[model samples]
Target: MSETSDSRAQRLAAESLAAGSPTAWFETLYDAAGRGAAEIPWDRGAPHPLLAEWLVQHAGEAAGADRTAVVPGTGPGHDAELLAALHFRTTAFDVSPTAIERVRAAHPDSAVDYRVADLFALPPQWRGAFDLVVEVMTVQSMPRTVRAAATAAIRSLVAPRGVLLVIGGVLPADPDPDYGPPWRLTHAEIEAFAADDLALEALDHGPDGLRYRAEFRRSRLLADTTSAIERTPC
Candidate 1:
């Protein structure tokens, strides 16, 4: 029996994770998708509704020419384009070269700076650099083994007084490693985003408490230099 495209993604992610290369399957997935053998399942073709609502709700706070935003693991850039529309100097990055390439191709006239970047090995200048970080559905897609580090990396992207919004599936119980390329996150895992200088300002649960939209804000009182980077793995 031939594996479906979705199943192929799961298999690729599983194999890469087992081999201790948690993010390597991203390139493989995009490469296959680029070759017309697969689909980017997470690409919603528009900004996520929850994110769109959040932006609308915070229009006063989010709209500004001086503001900067970044969407790490930005798959097809719907969210990035939305942010760019709001006058932010937005940057959307993905670890997969193929994914970035396709995004650039899809939006040749886009104002967004779509580039290739690894969350684990981000440029030093990017730390605490953005005025806003919209991290929807990115961290939860990673395995729990690296979930903490990934959360920290996302948290680190926000500038002092900035916001980090995380949207993802909520794990009702203990995370099962064998279940997903997009492994769901526990309450504790979600709380991890509030670590260090950030505080949980808002949390909204979706139907059956299976989805969540969490907002975290970093303290403006903190200096640019970080006291701790929270490099620990999940």
Candidate 2:
């Protein structure tokens, strides 16, 4: 009998964990999916509901006619497609080459630029270039030790006055030890994302207390001040 997709994913996840790479499984899974040997469990085939609602609420305001959005860990580009629909010049990137190809193939006419890139080593020009950065379940999928770096990297993608929307599993008040390939995030972990330049706007949990949605906004005032400082005479 042939090994099933779920089983393959499980095996890959185990290998990733054992290797301590934390992100290796992403490429492995995508490679399997590309070969029609495995299925991507999180490929919902549409933009996440939270993302859709966010776009509608800030339709004309936050996501104006000419803005840029980046979707990291863009599995099949569903969320990226939605952002493009709202007129944002969207860039969707995945660490897996095959994932990028799959999304591009799926949306042949899409204006969204799909690329293969790693979150940790993102193109320098992309730093603070996006008006909106959407990260859905990507950080939690990484190993615990690298989660902070991943969060910081995600934050770096947001430009001045930009918004970051994160959706992921949250660790329960009473945590479980055997918890994850989808590692659960804690309240402190989420709150720590806010800093001198970033501010937390909201943090809400799903009805069942299994998942959370966090919103952060970069300080436009700070950005402007920094720009002025850079332009000032020595």
Candidate 3:
């Protein structure tokens, strides 16, 4: 039998990890999918349910005239499209140029500003720039070596009083070293988003107990000990 998409993703991730470029395989995955050699395992063709519900609950506060939101690792652009439909000035990005190109092609007249950007080296103006950020499954995709950097990048996306929402599978305290391209997040890892000036406002477990939804907010009033990183420019 030919290689399945899941197996292909795993093989690519393993190869990329060994090469010291953990995220490099994402481009290859999208490229193969475009050529019909593979499918993207995570392209569910709908907004993630947990993220959709959160947006519904906050609908009144969610839409705004000049407010902006960002979605990282927006593979097929579902969540980003939904945010745009709800009237947010949304920017969505993926490191893979093929993925970015595909999402753009998928929505030629879309309001979302789709870009190819690496989360690790985002533009300096992005620091504390967005009024809201919805990150789903992105951080859990990173290896442990980049966990701090990943959380910091996510944290820096929110402006003061802005919100950061996360949704991901819950991993046990310790897991097998070879577990995933999505290396499911530990509770401590999720809590790291609150380490800087961001406050953990809500944390809920999905009914199945396998998933987590977390909400964080940066206080409009700066904390006395807040570092420049927390004050956040680049």
Which has the greatest TM-score? 3
CA RMSD for every model?
5.8, 7.8, 5.7
Error of 2 at 82 (Å): 0.2
Which 10 consecutive positions of candidate 1 have the poorest summed lDDT?
225-234
TM-score, candidate 2, is 0.87
**Cα deviation in Å at residue 148, candidate 2?**
1.2
Steric overlap count per candidate: 0, 0, 0
The model with the greatest lDDT is 3
Q: Which ten residues in a row have the lowest lDDT in candidate 3?
A: 225-234
lDDT order, best first, reads 3, 1, 2
Task: Provide the overall lDDT of each model, using Cα atoms, as 2-decimal numbers.
Answer: 0.83, 0.80, 0.85
**Residue lDDT tens for model 2, 38-72:** 88978888888777766776657545468999999
Candidate number with the higher lDDT (2 or 3): 3
Better of 2 and 3 by TM-score: 3
Q: Compared with the true structure, what per-residue lDDT tens digits does model 1 show for residues 1-234?
A: 988766887899889988889999999999999888888878889998778887888889768598999999999999999999989999999999999999999999999999899999999999999988998888877887888889989999999988888888777575565588678777677778886788777677765656778777888332322332222110
Candidate 3 lands at a TM-score of 0.91
**Model 3, total clashes:** 0
Question: What TM-score, to 2 decimals, does candidate 1 have?
Answer: 0.90
